[model samples]
Target chain A: MGDHDAPFDEPIDDPLAESLRRSLEPDPTLVPSAERVAAVRRAAERRAAEHDRNQNGPDSLRNAVSSRSLRPLIAAAALIVVGMFAALGLDRGPDGDVEYDGDIAGPGGDGTLRVVEIGIGRLVDLDTSDLAILPTGEYYELWFVGPDDTPDAPNRISAGTFHPDADGRSQVSFTAAVNPELLPTVEITAEPGDGDPRPSGVVVMSATIDR
Target chain B: MGGSSSRAARLDPTTLRQVVERARHHDPDAWESLYRHCYPALYAYAGRRLSPAVADDAVSDALARAIERIDRFEWRGAGFDAWMYGILRNVVKERYRHVTTQALPTDPAQLAQGLVEGEDASTALLARTEAAQIRRAFAALSESDQDLLELRVIAGLSAVETGQLLGKEAGAVRMAQARALDRLRAALRGGLDG
Candidate 1:
């Protein structure tokens, strides 16, 4: 037979209830460790990425990434460069292919913009002008930040490095391991040209690849 | 159910909604905030019901599951932590079934147990002995009694929240909780008498 000594109406503050709470309480120190939180957060982020991939096919994902990265930037800087840059960035060539354009904003953002055709993924007909010539020995490296938005190496893929000419203008483009359309954001970092593998904290410019 | 409210009720509902919205958008900062807010209580609940190692796994798996199914989650006033506990309850139940059917260990707590942290010899020994006694007595109760106690004390849920999770009215949960507590008290006394 079970003891029914206590009133059923009040279970919160009774002696037995307090004892149960205390007996079952876990060690205070281990309840919410940072390591556990980090592990769970990483797992959640992985699931989020997987969910994104499943919802949008790889082809559509390219456009999705492009739109996601660009929407905010364009909304913020919509009319800032209305007449400054002649190329509207959305202009299509005679071949009926639309051109993708974006603003490189940071240290030397003055009149600096990039135009490329990322339809098939890689940079095709990459064009950029009005770049600030860096001091000798410092070059600019291009990077594509994936949808993860983490600065970690796996998500930050380096496209390549290039040097500007005496006129502060140069254009040398090539294929990259990751599709710009898929990653959708371009980050230009000022590197010391010493062949360091990781991106330097000196990010000079960031641009959104508007599809 | 009318006796007390959940810890989640202390958090502002508007802020929780905003955090949930941000988390659903996959905002890292917002997600981290949500994780930190819910992890400790959920961990304690899992650790109490299962071993620490299994608790860790269940909490991680539950968080991942919650993230995947976040879009389907609607704010029904039960709060986010309650929703998370709901997922964790199912995960722990599944794990409990698997672990119970396995070979019994020298420590019966492994049958479905409480987590004890290691400490200095004398203090650790004393705490462990008491915790073990309570745990054993807790295990002796009927499944429903054990579950009600676990949901109320281990999960630290209020009568209302427990009622929501268990699909019982607050008044019913309180009545059930009182009965479960009486049994637990008797078990503890029985340990003392023995």
Candidate 2:
């Protein structure tokens, strides 16, 4: 409890005393996604390499060396990394989609849509924390390259894309009500950040509720 | 405040903050420990709010994100539990778009995730009843109250981060959260009685 001194409308000091705290709690175990980490590392390394090239090139290098400055670029890269991660942590509201902001490629689709075959193994993982959920606020958005549909398909303009965390792991399965495990759920394709609510991409991933 | 030293129980704020610090360093032990510590609670919270698969996805995704940002593990005298819990809440919210399409998600995933596994009808019924009660109680509160409760009880966020999520100061949140809880307690009590 805290000092109930500051605000006239402060919360009660003993807020949930009568309520039952979880007694026999389940273990908070996370299923690790190793494949994702590798992909993230690879991507990060690639970017780092490209950065190295750009900095060492005759023109940029001369500009930096002549003026004797490297901190700015370092700061810039740091900022970029922070920004990239910050993007990862974001779950954009209904209208934050940037159309073609940073979507690398389509997730899964046929030629008509340019679908990418996505799987748990396909995502890039970079977190050293061994956490199942990546640090990114969301997973990467996927696209159906063929005949697609978004969340509210026929209605919404675009298919819904489930973005991955920094490690690119997103939940695509739904739970059953009665049997909990008896019925299976469907999987939908990931949509781009197009600022649409309804999922408007082709159904790339799906599975019936596994009984 | 959480009362009674619960080991794997609701990780009091201090332990939670330490877990964040450990998880940040890629400490597999700490990572696993923290993951194991919060995942199920998150699962339950997500379950209450979403479908099973979506809940798992949210919990799993949250943990993955937690891994990446371990480097940003700012203790700030806050419990890692609340911080991580806050992340889980976002995961649930973000995944909602697709989850909405799924017809009936909670029951199946709840069973699958071993929430209310094979047991007597009474046991399952009781658990379901309690869950339903909680959900009903949760819905009765204001959106802000619901958010705070979910963050505190379900998400297990710290006072500071909880404030950050809702764009308020920790002290203000602490006060608001306590009041919110009082209101919730009243609501739950009334629901239980009336």
Candidate 3:
């Protein structure tokens, strides 16, 4: 069969195909409700605002001060504030709690994984927007892997197991008794229900802990 | 293809790409336009496999995820509709994992609407019967077959566009679609015989 280059090529002349098409035709009147559309728009706007804030954070302030004809005192004061914020580690959760954050991505999905040391153990918070849903009898497992980890001789500790919601968005928090300094790599894998306590090696997402 | 009012069908690829670009820059109007364009097909795809209520939530969730991940979206010439459908498909599959039973809408009158041009009573009745038959036959096919046909007939995606969403070669998709149609026809015949 020769593939057509056109994006939406019309179907061939077949009565069955035509009838199937008519039967499955989308109902024109079945539009999304205005409220639903508004909700989506609100979500988009919120994400946009967050993105803008991230993009225009400390670097943007430094650039604005240096590029403009500002007074020396104001520029120096702005720089000092930026420096203080950076030095204080504003992203840390609380006093004596070291936080590590990184992006986890692989084919068909991506997410953010955050680890925080809460004195007793580590807390992992995973937020994925587009992870594929595993079939029944299978689930996704999170692992904190050490530097010497390998496929054959895997050196890792399980944080938890979870399945994404119907929306393929998973926001989960799990507490594990491990240290981020020892297990600096985080991994997510699709594991079968075989009861085998081993890394399946089917890594869907992985990232190094960025301190 | 004949009577589809899907906004995606109305938008040319160039205009759609422009709108997607604007949405990438976080333009509210652009996102609105994109949502309207893709909503019809996305709803149809989800509604076919899910209950009406779940379908609505699935579409909303797909759009929400699209907004969050729009920054990472790259243009590959399949247009934004395919991209939105890709997300919706994943959402639908996730829903399927949780659901042991699907609530497919099989109302003959509802399925028959707009299938025929004339408003005549007899024609409408015939349309309803035929539509019911088609729906039954369509449902009897394997899930993979139904998915292919849904992409081709319902979503109005070309083989190439379906391939892009499914991560398959265009020729392979075309061949598979033909095979799927054959299976559907066989299923229809089996239904009639039964």
Candidate 4:
């Protein structure tokens, strides 16, 4: 037996305590199944990401970049821009697709945001890394912020809401009926599930739409 | 004697601290390693008190809660294991409350039978009578005594760690555990005689 099984300040030879300990030992077959372990792992990864976000906030990527030399930041941006072009080249639907791409950064992390006009509605694609997973009853909202918007009372159109994957990365696409040029700025906010249509004002990621 | 293979070896304090630090930063591998190390003990504690299905649910719930609130966990004398026990304790109590109301098995015989049911046929056959008797005596113990013994034996917590989780001094935990053992002995003897 490990030292943990040794009696507390008493001799280890106590037969009654020994008997109780032996009886209480869990059945070897009582181990968690593979599915259960996977489920737990998924939950842990998500919680870890959420905890990271809560501790660092939406500016985690910026803060990390700001503290280090500009080389890594420049490299990360270059990589993202290259990735955006590569994706757009393959993903370009037809003539007059009207694609606008820019950078989104906040507590969750930094990534490229692409808005493509697909005749009926605008398709918003967000590819971000180090995004935090929100707790249940909370969600991340995407918005089109107008130029004349104030911090307190902003005029914005809601695109949709999404939660990031357990790995703190989001590569999600949402379609909304809004003109990107009219709104100018794209923003993401962490919203509570209070059934309110208004933004929670907790901006997670934001970027200007390249016209 | 029957099911020793499932028991997880405790991590040393230094390694545990490092793992916890990495886990706090949202490291998936770190979180996986930590959970794997802690799962056995947590499951043992829950499994003894609850049915197999309920025990699994309770451990899962406790782990989810732990993940949700891991940022707020601070390193102290009791370490992360004890902190996890504290969380599991709450989950078990909540489950016990619900299960009791539903009239699920809460008696010594039922608990003993549950243990036996978990073992394979050969192990069950070899240790059924003695194990069941011991379990019955243990189940007959006061709630506090049961908790103390479970922490010390099933969860493999040291006296100091058990005390920390139970909100008592180490010396006091030792004293209480000794008295609990005496009561268990009397109960066991009575069972054998009767």
Candidate 5:
């Protein structure tokens, strides 16, 4: 009850969602051109490298030395944790939870896409709708082809990573402990295909999964 | 089935890693592959966050950082995208602070609770009317309110990290978030209802 009242209890959306529909309709005028987008990307990569060098200076190379040494400690702890968890009666949950994500494009808004994975639990949901039994450690990440932002600049929202059902297809399912209504659209990067519950290295596939 | 084969033609994470590893070792072919693969999205993220001029700088900086850093890349479960994002987040956050001329979002929830979810039906409806309208309205918000709303609700940054990035005292981010949210409610309701 800050300055405004809570709408959650109201449970009333725009009468017919006419406004929501109109709001979603894309505007051709605002769309980023391909040429402009490509130029920005080329420039950004050049700049990222330059900035890193300037900030880190020559000492940057040596800095990784420490990070590398600490890696083992992290890995060791992870391993011990894994071992202990395994030894305990700790039981893993059902293996059927599938995750998915995609992008949501609204004209003239942030022009930024969001994390829209639907099948996994990190930043998204475990769509129990379809129980096809997907594995852990392997999931998807989203990426776009042109400039990341609509108006200008380039940026990639992780769009989240999730476990895909073995069958790899299902109904619309999304549960977000975060913001649910404004969930981003999703695409499958196919970064991982295992049951390990993590994103694989490469983006294999992506689709603009819309609502 | 042919679609699957065609898709396989595109690099997956393992293949992308191999490409990066080759590039790290000075393999021109691998370098070319790496550039071809990551250039699009990385470039896109930068362009949107910064001006074209600064974007060029940021992108090149990230790449160079990767070159020097590529060796150190452990290729843990986290892929280059995750690693790159970690670096890019800093770049965007730095620019956000500079351009907006504001201190850290003392109250982070103001962004998420307010900007994204307005309690007033009329206000939420208005914000959802047009992305631009919302953006312009968003721009008018006070410095703290803007930051909190952008990172938490709009940009969807984590509350704890939003606090760290905004530079409020420890635990202040949370309390601030509550207050910030209140501010947002006021702004949206005030802006829209009126």
Candidate 6:
């Protein structure tokens, strides 16, 4: 029998292996947000468009212009098309500034927070001071809960995790792929270091912000 | 090999080829399927190795690069995920260079993306304690051991697939995995006992 067929007597659910599994496997429900998916789609579209132009545009134009022998016009046209696609590949989000701010309410009413929807993704900035101390072995996680009408109905995207200082204060800045408009509710939940990917259902603080 | 065939059975051969073909042609459905298929595994691997912020950027950049270079990617024995992983390694390497040179992050707020936000505080605390113990043992392993674990567990690649990426035979990969697990178990025991 090949090595692959050599069955080990050892159980697959050995404690060490289970621990490794728990530590490594992310939350199964975790997925790319709609905005992230849209960004990728847009990027792929631009690349596909560029690829098509590279394949057909120059060749067809070359054939046509070759019949008339209009070499300079073909060169100029190719350059213009290349330039246009390059510009298309650039940031497609709004040119204007888009920002949202609100205060998170907890035992001590944690400080102000900001969510800036820039091109492609959202920038989440959180600041807290003199908040209630969390129990040992727990940290705070930032979540972006989408609006009720979202297709997922009730979905929350984890921004990331953080732990406050000795004084029960923390400042965090991170980017998330969620749409700022879709995510009006920002929640902070105390989470364990366990491998579970979903929020712990413990809402330490929460706020509704307008964009 | 039986293991190889079993894992390969999950991906229908026809659908695999079709996904690649349609994605090359810029079919939205195909692209979405491909993206969704690879994103979770890629995110897990990158998130463990780097901060969530860098991990997200690396995944996005890797997918964009794959889309741009899809035409050039030939269907080798491995699937599309393997090819994408190769690109992702390069991107992660670039970021790793930057991270290693910079001073470690001092912000107490900086934490990895993965956390258990379950309802029971006591359960969560026990889980965290166990997780921390496991992490310490894992860190005690050799770099090669860590890499193998990362590829198998974090990347969620089957033994045969991991073998293909590492250019080793399936038999050798299985042996390595067994030995690595054994070492990890010993390390964990030592941590608990000592």
Q: Which structure among the candidates has the greatest TM-score?
A: 3
Summarize candidate 1's per-residue lDDT along B84-142 as a digit string, tens digits: 77667666664453553212132645533454545555475566666667776887787
Q: What residue pairs clash in candidate 1, if any at all?
A: none
Candidate 6 scores a chain A TM-score of 0.48
Per-model TM-score versus the true fold:
0.47, 0.41, 0.60, 0.51, 0.31, 0.49
Q: Chain A TM-scores, all candidates?
A: 0.45, 0.21, 0.59, 0.53, 0.22, 0.48
Error of 6 at A41 (Å): 1.9
In candidate 6, stretches whose alpha carbon ends up further than 4 angstroms from where it belongs are A1-15, A33-35, A61-211, B1-18, B100-128
Residue-pair clashes per candidate, as listed?
Answer: 0, 87, 0, 4, 68, 3
Give the Cα error of residue B12 in candidate 6, in Å. Answer: 8.7
The model with the greatest lDDT is 3
Candidate 1 lDDT over A46-138, as tens digits, reads 867877787778768668657877878876676666543436543444323343444465433323444444545455233343233443465
Clashing pairs in 3: none
Ten-residue stretch with the least lDDT total in model 5 chain B: B1-10
Instruction: Give the distance in Å from residue A127's predicted Cα in candidate 6 to where it truly belongs.
Output: 50
**Tens digit per residue, CA lDDT, model 2, A1-211:** 1111212232334524323234213334433244433433344344446555765797776677557377777788988898976777543322232112111211121111111112221121111111122123322232222223334333111123334344324433211122212212233433333555444332333323222
Per-candidate iRMS values, in order, are 21.6, 12.2, 6.4, 11.1, 17.8, 16.4
lDDT of 6 by residue, B1-194 (tens): 00111111222456767787988887766776776666666776666566776777778878887787787666543456666665565566544535532223323233322554666655766666667667667767875576667666555455655554443445655677778889998998998899
State the displacement of the C-alpha of residue A190, model 3, in Å, after optimal TM-score superposition.
Answer: 14
Off by over 4 Å in 4: A1-13, A28-30, A55-211, B1-17, B100-127
Query: Candidate 1: what lDDT?
Result: 0.61
TM-score of chain A of 2: 0.21
Candidate 2 residue spans exceeding 4 A from truth: A1-17, A20-211, B1-30, B101-132, B153-161, B178-194
lDDT of 5: 0.41
Q: Supply the TM-score for candidate 6.
A: 0.49
Tell how far residue A190 is off in model 2, in angstroms. 31
Q: What is the per-residue lDDT of model 3 for residues A1-211, given as tens digits with 9 covering 90 to 100?
A: 1112236575755678889988878765455676776887898789889988988897778887686577787869988998987798864666446567777875435788777787669988999865555545678899999987887877789999998785667999999998877888888877766899787666767888756
TM-score of chain B of each: 0.70, 0.61, 0.81, 0.75, 0.47, 0.68
- lDDT tens per residue, model 5, A1-211: 0001111121212321232223223221222233433443454455456766776876775586468667888788989998986676343323322233333321100112333332443233323211111213333344333333332443334434444332322223333333222433343334334454333323222334333
Ranking by DockQ: 3, 4, 6, 1, 2, 5
